[model samples]
Target: MKVVIVGAGIGGLTLALFLHKAKISCEVFEAAPAIRPLGAGLNLLPHATTAFSELELLDRLLERGVETSEVHFYTHHGQFVDGEPRGRFAGYDVPQISIHRADLHEVLLSAARERLGDEAVRLGRVCRSVEQDPERVRVNFADPSGAALPSEEGSVVIACDGIHSVVRKQFHPDDSAPIDHGTTCFRGVTRWKPFLDGATMAYVGTYDTGKLVVYPIRNSIDAEGKQLINWVIEVKKPNDGVRDWNRQVSIEACIEPFVDWRFEWLDIASMLRATDEVLQYPMVDRNPLPFWTRGRVTLLGDAAHPMLPRGSNGAAQAILDARLLAELLATKEPLIALKEYEATRLPATADIVLTNRNRSPDEILRIVEERTGGQPFEQISDVISRGELDEWQSRYKRVAGFERERLPQ
Candidate 1:
């Protein structure tokens, strides 16, 4: 059976690789005339790493990405809140990778092109719609000029399109527009001297006012030992702006919130000012649809489950979805496989969506922020008990399908 996949971003390419490995015939349709590495850093948690390892691309990813040793939490004052060894350090078999979104995309895209052939990924093809009957599925696309282009037929079609997916619209046309998180995030990558362990994922401050999440995506350049640091500034607000991922943000608007964030280990204020470019994205997600599969077409990645970017599950869940869909298709009938895929994942991801909305790992900071009345205490232990913090972290892990005791083997 032949399959057609829409969108050539991370999810689409990953799906193509999985299909190729399973000996399933498929083609990828990407809207961009050319795929260039775009966007900021993305975390590939262990579960997702498991999928990449199956595709034989882990070594290449390790070469291009930073293997994060620990994920640490901090207050606006830079005081340590909590730190945990991630990936193998945390006892998971796979190591967590902090990679440039572009680097990860390129690695997957190159592998897909090499294995599936240049014709496998049809660029300059914008998928406008898909139609499926009992016997076959047809996909329609337009060129960059907005002129109608030829349509292709396949046994099935999967939409891996990013957040604003047209196919998802066809499935849930009556769904209210995606709800905004009431927080606008400004992100950028800058070449700067390393901070902390040089491979730390750090989240600081509170979003009630402003918060910063910073990490190193690349180790060094020019032999100066300067690392590529990716940082995001999220602020609570009635944000009004375009929702485009590539939207440029004025450094002044978001930087002001962190100006007073002076700390001993790193001058948070200075780092914010050093950024060369800043991109703004409003944290927005739609209510989870009751289903993602209908007839011969199914949805994966952001198309199926778009959630808040917090907790690093955006790409991880997409990777998991691709692998699970491939597994189901390999073992079951296509239509039944789609339903089984949804049965296993839809509720699972819905938990992630709501968990991200309420109690993510960062909730520890929220607890500290409120319990201490946003003031520093002589000892963090006095502010919040270790048990409480561990509980908060554990709960999120369970919902994200990574609880310490229950992680998949």
Candidate 2:
């Protein structure tokens, strides 16, 4: 099947790689004039890493990123809540890799070029709409000046355009603007010495108040033995400003609430202040669509379901979507393949969207904060048992399709 993929993101690039692997004809179109690495760091769980393992890109990702050894949760007061091993340390065959979004994007971009050829990716093509007949689906594009460009034709089109997807909008024309869940995330990267074990990922505080998730994305980028740490500050707001990911705000405004985030393990306030740039994004998501596949067009990644970003499944689920869609399309007829892709992934990702909305692994800190009444406890066991904490983590894992037991030995 000849496939046209909209949005050359992690999901789109992944789909491109898989299509090439299957020797299926496909092309990737991106809106941006140039694909620069954007956004912060993200965790690659085993389920997501499995895609990399199959593609033989796992080692390259780990070489540039930190192999997450453990995950730690702490209260806003800096008291420990609970900790657990991750990646191979958790006994999963694949290691959970943590890396900057830009680095990961570049890796995927480079691989796509090498495997699919340089001319495979068409940049400066912003998809405005799509139309499909019985034979082929075509996407209308616009140039940088908003001038209409020639429409591209393919057997099918997959929208990976993210939350602001134009293809998705064309399908669900009246769909209301993205529903804001009252949370705003301020994210940035800072160079600092390792706090806990060098490869640990930490989630401190609670989202209702002020939550901080910090982890090292790159190791030893500077001469002073400092690792590039990615941190996020999330706070519940009655009203949020713009929802753009690259929206810049005063660094002081971003770190104002985190000013008192001082801890023995790491000085949160200092780290927040040390960052050169801070980008703000509203924690927003759309309700699951009734179906992702409509005729010969479909949605993937944030376009299909933009879940709350707390659960660390944003990119993971997208990667999985690409893998599955390519698998089905490589076998079934174009139209039937789109339907089968939706049947397999729609319900699965929808569940994760709701799960992340209600109670995600990130809420482990919120749970402890509630039990302790937002105060430090003599013992973490006093606030909550280890079983409860383990349940929180495992339950989300199961929903995200990465539960250790669910995998084959």
lDDT of 1 by residue, 1-409 (tens): 8889999988899989998888889999988898776789988888888788889998999998899999888887688988889988888877889999999999998899899998899999988988878899899999988999999999889999888898999989997777887887789988888888888899887887578888988877658898888898788874584778788867998887788887776777888888888888858888999889889998899898899899999999988888888887887888888889899999999999988887777767887888878777688888878898788877877788765456566
The TM-score between candidate 2 and the true structure equals 0.97
Superposed Cα RMSD, model 2? 1.3
C-alpha positional error of residue 405 in candidate 2 after TM-score superposition, expressed in Å: 2.5
Q: Write the per-residue lDDT of candidate 2 for residues 282-373, one digit (tens) a residue.
A: 68889999877889999999999998887789999999999988899888988889899999999999999999887888787777777878
Minimum summed lDDT over a 10-residue window in model 2 is located at 236-245
lDDT of each: 0.86, 0.88
Give candidate 2 regions above 4 Å deviation: 238-241
